[model samples]
Target: MPTREEVIEALEAARKKLLTEDAKKEFKGWNRTIQYYFTDSDEYWHFKVEDGIPGELINTEAEDAEIQFKMKEDTLIGLIDGSINGMRAFTMGKIKVKASLKDISKLQKLV
Candidate 1:
């Protein structure tokens, strides 16, 4: 399993790839937050995306996020690297999300 810094780095790379392709526009006007709980380390990393930038890292006390995803760190790394499909993993119960179906659907496109 990768460390928290490694995971953040991977996510940043993914975000850059998405942005370079002009994919960030897909999230325009969308303000959502997601918390990733890495089971191995039992660490929680929060990601908040609003207006533009790749969102910010937040502490545990952050308010209710619009979306939250929980899964093993390795699985998350796979998802970011395109080895795992986010939607499929979620449907297969490997990834758990707490959010509206509508928002979840939109997130699928982004991932």
Candidate 2:
């Protein structure tokens, strides 16, 4: 299994790739926030995308987020690294997402 720092680095790389896409450019204008909680260590990290740039991490629970997703830390790294697909994992009961239907749909585009 990869370490927490490795996972975070991968996620950041993935986020940067997504931000450069034409479809994701609109996200740069929105105040988008995502919270990832590593189930194994029970550590929560929050990310915010603002003004076309990824913001710094914030240590706080995302009580009311536009979208929230849950998955094992290893699984999350795999998904972000293209080793696994989010839909496939979710369909196989390996991942869980909680949010409005619209947000879930939007997540498909984001992730």
Q: Report the C-alpha lDDT of model 2 over 6-110, residue by residue, as the tens digit.
A: 877866765665466664675556566777766776766677766546677665667665556567788888887789988899899787776678656755676
Best by lDDT: 1
TM-score of each: 0.78, 0.78
The 10-residue segment of model 1 with minimum total lDDT is 14-23
Q: Supply candidate 2's per-residue lDDT for 37.
A: 65
Off by over 4 Å in 1: 14-21, 59-61
TM-score of candidate 1 against the unseen true structure: 0.78
RMSD vs true structure, all candidates: 2.4, 2.4
lDDT of each: 0.71, 0.69
Candidate 1 local lDDT, 1-111, one digit each (tens): 687777877656645543544556776676767666666777777767776445656546347877777788778888888899877887898888889988877766665
lDDT of 2: 0.69
Report the C-alpha displacement of residue 44, candidate 2, in angstroms. 0.8
Residue 54, model 2: Cα distance from true site in angstroms? 3.4
